[model samples]
Target: MDNTTLVDNANVVATPNGVLPLAASVELVCSSRTFVPFLFVFCAIYHFLAPLYTTPKQLSWILTTVASATMTLVSIPFVWDYVSSGGDVKSVRTLSSLTYATTRMFQAYLVSDLIMGSIYYRNQLMLLTGWFHHILYVFIVQICIKRAWTQIFCLCALMELPTFLLAISCLYPRLRSNVAFAVTFFLTRILLHLIWCISYLIPSNRTHTTGGSILPSVMLAGVFPLHAIWFKGCVKGFIKRRKENRALAPQAVTVDAVALAHATIPSSTSDSYISFRSASHNHPARKDYSLSTLHHIGYRLWPARKAIYSFVGLGRQTSS
Candidate 1:
């Protein structure tokens, strides 16, 4: 297809053969903003349905509610613009200043947020449905009709607010470490997204609009499953270790109690013998070394060596 036709299909006005022009290839950018509320409703419903997924507590719910309400409120103007524009690309620009820059910047944040939200909720969303969102997005982009950047960003921003809310909950001390880890891991993936944004500002890359779209799709496909697999593996390992600990804990406590009693009783008994010997003889010079002396010494020493042996299975004779 000629550059003009390709640009038209992307719903972008062609720039003078540059990266910014290619970035404009993300047509329908603000078009997706129209559907943001519906996406939020879906996420809220999804959050409730999956018990396996973590849910926000009451305080978190308040924060989520407030943030969501604000985001929804801000969309009023954009929605009005969208409705008044009648879905025409030119009409949208007529109503808005720096329409291209505004849309692409939003697109960059939205698309990256969508991919990250999918990663965050993979267990809850995919565990039962096995990645319905991934399949759905694929179908929409490849078969239903080509998606514009507007649509992608709107859907993304819709999903992101909830994920960010969840992240806020995880920032508590108990979960802060894991939250930090997830944040760091998620940031690495955004580098690719940042590239997508930068490509839009440059002109040389516009010739192959498909290249930009394909990069995100390929990255997400690989990342989503990789996250799912890693999460599943971690869950499995955790369950296995917990079961083993349950079995081992009681026995360990019993063994400790018995060992402690055995350890204390002998020392006390030995102390009594020494007291009796000293009282009866009035001095060590008059006391005879009896068979009991040898036995009592051996018994007390046995407990110490046995404790060492049980800990790491060291042989008693090793010290000898």
Candidate 2:
């Protein structure tokens, strides 16, 4: 019986199936194990270099830009094929040669950035979703490397392209005031991820063996809903900011109009204008004693006087 079992196992192993052989699997695992120490060393070097940046924000922006450039360059071929094939997963090519090395390097950057971000902004880092995302990503990449799922990994990495823009929006305060960043974020991070999960990952999991593709599919499935929630928040925030800007538009226009009015004052009133401006600047405290200030003070005191009268009446009634 033992001999029969051994022979059957040997036949299964020798079969020219698409699955990796045991020796190849072991080698891949060993390579992954060896690569982890290098990743740690790189992260350590990045941490030590953090002091070179003037501010934490600058360091974050620089790291994000570097990571974005690396991933964008490496995943371009995969992205092109995916798009050209009309979003067909089968059309996507696996990473190879320099591209594979670049992808690995980008992953190292992600890990290092996460570690450094946590160290520098420990409090704010806890409030961000990125901490969990980065932790999950490291595990996902390790799994993809071990299973040789380079195409799927590339698809996943492509999400970082929009993330680069998101980082840019954070770096440039002006970008945050518009809807462009939010729209791009929704399209790339939320919409693309949703499509990938529904069209590619789910279908692949259904057709492929559990050993090769299940973990990645499951991980993506678990992450998709979170992205959906984040997208909803982004939409709401965009609307809120738009409303705020609109509300402030009139106030800004009024200020501009007042400045124009002041500029158009006749030359004959130059002396009066100069005296007014000098008094306003030199005696700011005295300028607060205006009709508007008095009106506001009266409005506040009215409520207090009513409360005091009510309290005195209640006290007299209780004593009687």
Candidate 3:
């Protein structure tokens, strides 16, 4: 009856209630049109905060970690609603304003990272892998949003859970040894992704009775292989790193955590730890992340601890 029949789903014109009146304006605002503006915005913000991190990598990690956490958290309620309602058609075909805004914002962030990484953090970016991944996501997210695949997009966003952990660990390498990252990565990216794909493959799946478009399904299935490949490589790398760590004796190749932090961390980050070792309690020269700081604190607390222990021993003897 309207442009609804004439127009395609590639634009955000179609909704559960038929053709949306402000669809064009809203789409333009929430679509890839914001990419350039967001790019400039993120670039300016990161440059402003760059001095705090000392390196593009650390700054980039801070942005991505926050973005990933935000997207994951924001998607949870929508995703939970979709799943709990048993894949209502409205949840899939209907695009909400919040989901649209969140998707576009995250897309802008990813686009900014790709462009900025190319110019500033080229050394940190993987040639083929990173480029292909970001490009694919940036391109696909727009299409998915346009086609109103918010539920599937939200489900896929859970994979970023691992990125939050890994990205934060870049600044704090001591937590890098934790197996939680690898485990979460495998669970979300590999196992959960595989299940989603299988459900998509199943015809007439009651549990996920949303859309049945082959193209969207194909697009989703495509990412599973990439996830699997990344997981495999991650596991191998984790194993190798652990083996190397086990082979080395304690502090054999390294000094204390402070020295290790200095040797490995960017100078900008380490120098910010002023009050860590300052005796005057004012801003004094000291490294916060170190073994000696732990020893110093423990040494200062030992007398009180001994006194408490002696009191407990005396109480126990009196009871006996």
Local distance difference test scores for all models: 0.41, 0.60, 0.65
Residue 19, candidate 2: how far off, in angstroms?
22
Give the poorly placed runs of model 2, Cα more than 4 Å off.
1-53, 97-103, 172-177, 201-214, 264-320
* Best of the candidates, lDDT: 3
| Cα RMSDs, all models | 21.2, 16.9, 11.9
Worst 10 residues of 2 by lDDT: 1-10
Better of 1 and 3 by TM-score: 3
Better of 1 and 3 by lDDT: 3
Task: Please give the distance, in angstroms, between residue 251's alpha carbon in candidate 2 and its true position after superposition.
Answer: 2.0
Model 1: number of clashes? 11
True-vs-predicted CA distance for residue 196, candidate 1, Å: 22
The superposed Cα distance between candidate 3 and the true structure at residue 134, in angstroms, equals 1.1
Q: Write the per-residue lDDT of candidate 2 for residues 1-320, one digit (tens) a residue.
A: 22212223433222334455566654555557655664776666656655765666655665676677567667778889889999876667665454445546656766777777777755445434667766777777766665666567676677776667776666565665346656766777777777776655555543542333556667677887777787788788879987997787656645533443344222333443454355345433332344664354334323234334553564224555
Error of 1 at 243 (Å): 3.3
